[model samples]
Structure formats: structure tokens, C-alpha cells
Target: MSIFKKVSESERNTKATIFVGNIDPKVNEIMLYELFIQFGKIKSLNLPKDRISKTHQGFGFIEFKTEADLKYVVQIMKGIRLYGKLLRVKQAENKSNDTKSVSNKPRTVDIGAKLFIKNLNPLIDEKYLEDTFSTFGEIISTSVDREANGESKGQGFVVFNDFTSSDNAIKNINGKILMNSKVVVTYAYKDDKQKTKHGDKVERLLATNAKKHKMLDSSTQPTKKQKR
Candidate 1:
């Protein structure tokens, strides 16, 4: 007998949802509902299927009536093994404000507009990085390195659609303080030798600029005679 057969329509509330990943294709909604319903009452469960083959898409969403239940399930399901795989469970990001009206096609990346950034605050993630730099231009993608435990690796890359936007970002944001940490932003280089050579040059320039700024500030201060 299917467990979902007993779920009444009145119990449905698709408010708080969580994303479940690494799902086996053989797993069905009935098995999922039976597994998750042990923690809380589920409003809805969805495993997207291909139109032609009708196989599970290897991911699903589970909606619960209350936020408390949703949180509880996420906490308990963090490392739970199912179908010989460790399930990846997390809170689903709200896409209500997403620009879905725009075309769904993937944006083209301008190789010249790719940037490499380092010394990121551990708290900064891909979404935060995107939000911080989105004002410069239409971003194609943002990626932050992470450890297996999901800790930030303090480095990332951002790609924009045009070179001008990336240039503007380097001018305005390089050496700027983000989350109490100064970050280094530079053009991403494909060759190791080029990256090292350019990195050294940028470091030297930054040091020289810092020294020049200190001298300029000291020179501008009024001496006793000048003040008199």
C-alpha cells in the first residue's frame, strides 16, 4: 500500500520547502514521503522527471506546512544515507524575485572579463560575491572555492559579459575592505607563468601606491610655521 495514499488534501501547505539532492533514480515519491514524514507532516513532495524518459531528475523538493518542521528535517537529514548515497539537504533559496521574465538561455562569457579574487572572508559565499559585484555589470557566473565541509577557501572567480565591467570592478574593488578583510582582485590568467608574473607586478604596485599615499598625506599636513 502506498503511504501517500493516506495524505489528505487539507494537510497540504507548500510554504517552507527544502531541496534534496543525490536522489537515486529508482526512488519514488512514496518512498520519500514515508522517509521524511517520520520527522514532520509534509505538504508536498516533488521529484522532477524528464518528459521523455520520465526518470527522476536526481533531485527533489519537499514542502512542509510549518517552518519549524522544515528546519527540523534539514537538521536531521544533513548526513543521512539513503539508497547507498549520502543525501544533500539544504534550505531552498527563494526565487520569487528572480528575473524569470528574461530569456532562459545561458549568457555568454567574455574571456577578457573573467576575474580572480582572493583573501575573501570565510563567511562570503558565491551568492554574496555575486551580490557584491553585480552592480558593475551583468555577471555570467560566480564561484567560490569550498572545502568538503562547505567552508570557504578564501578565493573565487567572477565572470562578466564584457571587459569594461571587469575593468571597472578591478579599479573600484581591488584592495577594498570586504567583511573586515582586504581582498585582492586581478585579471584571471590561464598560464601559470603569466599569473605569477602579473601577480608579482600587482603586489609591487600596491606596495608602491601605499607608500605614495602615506607620503602624500604627510606632505599635506600643516607644519607649525604653515599653521602660524
Candidate 2:
């Protein structure tokens, strides 16, 4: 008997979805179905393809008939080697709820309070990124850049309530590794004005350091008053 035949329409309506990333280009939908069906009945599978190449994108989404089945697959398949590449599997985001929540919120913009992060691991989602930087200050927002099909672009932004928090995050979190990927963090400039302001801030910090160094050098010099 076909495994999908046992799943009813109602069960399909409440299907739990999972995102599978780092998929080998050679693996097709048929291969995925054949491999995953052994765990449970699958309601649907979507492997987005490139428009020109028509090859499956390096990621896909799978909807299972039940949450338990989806969890089991995620637990078993995560980090599993397929075609010599480790798979990245996790629960898919509920985009509809996220969109609704964001649309209902009042927008507040703060200049010089956002940090740009680059070279993030594919497994590092928005929640994980936010939690890692939350020790510095209250975060206003966090976002991970993604393609239309939801593959990570390996970069993100963290917006804090104030400039101090953002600066602190850049100083501490930059050059740190998370999930085996070293990230680069810097000020996210929205316009020319912000860029100029950031340049001024850097100049001021350099001037201060130079002045301190000069003072220390002068203090270490020997006095010539004994010759008089």
C-alpha cells in the first residue's frame, strides 16, 4: 500500500513542515521522496528550481501529515551525510503569522543603531542570531537575508534600541565563530549621512588613542634639568 494513501485531507490541512538545506544538486524530488517515505507519510514536497538552469535549488521544504513524523525525520536526518554533504534540517518558519505580526507593529526607525553581520552559517536562523547578541542590549529587530525560496544568503542585520548596544555588539561579536562559521559585524549604514557619521566616530576614536599613546611616551622620557 502507498504511504500517502493513508493520509486524509484533514491531516494534510494541519501538516507540519520542515526545511532541508545544503541538498546535493544531483538529488531530485524522486530521490528525496524515496528516502523520506520510510519514516512517515508525506503530504507534500517542494523543491524550488532555478528559473534558467531548472536545477533544484540547494534547499527544499517537506510537509508531513503529522507533527510527530516531522519531528522524527528532523531528529534522524539532521547532519546526515548525503552525497558527501551534511544536511541542515529544521522546522520551517510560519511565514503567514510572521507577516501578520510584523504588519501590525508600529514602525520605529533609529539611526546608527543597526549592525550588519556576514558569513553566517546556514543553520543560524534569526532567533539564534538574536539570542547570541542579546547579551549586549535590548534588540529592536533581527533579520537574516534569504532568497525567494528561503535559502540563507549567509548575512543578517541586528537592530538595537540604541547606538551603544549596536557598537558593543560590533566590538564583541565581530570575528567570533558561531556554528563553525566566523562572522564579520559592522555598522549598517542606511544612507550617505550615516556613513559620514560613522567615519567621524572612527576618526574620533583613533585620535583619542593617539593622544593617550603620546602622553605615555612623554612620561617615560628622562628629565634634562640636571645640566642647568
Candidate 3:
């Protein structure tokens, strides 16, 4: 199988929740709700706490009513300099998976008003992204993905207030050269949360391969010649 699979026409659309990680230990769900509320309507905000200390676990999950809002949070809030640390954000796994086997397919999700732009120049910053995409419409926020050492990750996101603006930017700015490299733009896959399922598949494949290797080893072993 190819390492990089082309997103199906159906996968282009999605997001409803995101996993917020690397959060400040002191941050509470109320603070999180306050911070994320600006992006869109929220469905739920959960911050697991230590049963004894009554302290947060340093990570939480936030659910938005619309995929657009969820994408906005994932894209624009990631790597944000908050509380003297950068925040890590991504799609949240299904809560139901804790009780049952996860399905390969995710639930139906709505398309968000955000775009994922890749193949970017390492030097590109959030300002450059905003400036470039602003031509299409008002940009609510922007982000340049980066490494832990503060180096650019050669990718970023641009979030518009409306889906129309995002679509326009994708149509006009996608594949355009930026800093000598052509960029790829597409709708953010904000609702995708299949990491656990993928890991399961990998484990199963390795087990199967191990069994095959054992059988081959036994079959290939030389038999002792019988005395005639």
C-alpha cells in the first residue's frame, strides 16, 4: 500500500472535535472554554482531573457544533504561545472507542471553513500566510506549523470566517508558487481520528508476518538423511 493515500472525495469534508494537548497544568476547562469560544459554538469541553489533587491532567478535549469551528481551533490554536509553552492540537478520538472496537470509517462530519496548505517554504510565517490568503476574504486566523525547536514544518493553515472565502482561496491560491515552491491547499481533515485503528492494523499485520516466518523456517529446515 502507498504510504500516502489520496483522500477520497468523501473525506474532504469533516470536524467536530479536537484533542488539546500540552496545555498548562493550571489551565481548567473554563479557561479552555473561554479561549476556544471565540472560534465558534461549542458542544462540550472536557478536562480530566486528578481525582485526589483536583488538578487538570494537562490535556483536554473540545467539541464544536460545526466542523468549521473545530477546524478553526485545530489550525489556528496549534503551537500558540500560551502560558510560556506551545499548545498541541489535533483531531480527537471517539469517546465510544473506550468501550468497543473502533471502526475503520469515521462518522459523517461537516466540512469546515479552513484550508490546509502544504509544501510551504520553511521560512514562511503566519503573517505571510495571512497576507497571501487575505486576498480572497477576511481571514479569521492563520498558523505556521513548526517543530519543537521552533523551526518551520513546511506547512500551515489559513482559517476564514466563512466557507466561501476559504473555497475561493483554495481555488485561486492552491498550487501557486510561494517562496519558490508550489503549495497544495485543501480542506482541513479536522474530524479524522483513526490513529488507534491504524495502529491496530499494523499490529495485526506484524503478527501475521511472524507466523508466516515461523512456518517458512520449519518448512525450509533440512531433514536428516534416513539410514538405507
Give the TM-score of each candidate: 0.43, 0.40, 0.40
Q: Which ten residues in a row have the lowest lDDT in candidate 1?
A: 98-107
| Pairs that clash in candidate 1 | none
Which portions of model 2 miss their true places by more than 4 Å? 1-109, 191-228
Native-to-model Cα distance after best TM-score fit, residue 126 in candidate 3, in Å:
0.4
lDDT of each: 0.61, 0.61, 0.57
Tell me the spans in candidate 1 whose CA falls farther than 4 Å from its real position.
Answer: 1-107, 191-228
lDDT tens digits by residue: candidate 3, 1-228? 121222332332225767666455457666777888888877667665543335554456666778878777777875575453356677765544311211011121111356788999988876678678877755544666677777777887765534456667878988899999999998665445622311133433543454366522231222221000
**Candidate achieving the largest TM-score:** 1
The TM-score, computed over Cα atoms with residue i paired to residue i, of candidate 2 is 0.40
Question: Model 1 TM-score?
Answer: 0.43
The sequence of per-residue lDDT tens digits that candidate 2 reaches over residues 1-228 is: 243242332444433777676566568887888888898888787666543335654566678889999889989996565554446677765533321221111122222356788999988876687689878765545667676656678887776544556667888988999899999998776554654433236633543454366522232122221000
Across 178-204, the per-residue lDDT of candidate 1 in tens digits comes to: 999999998777455553322344543
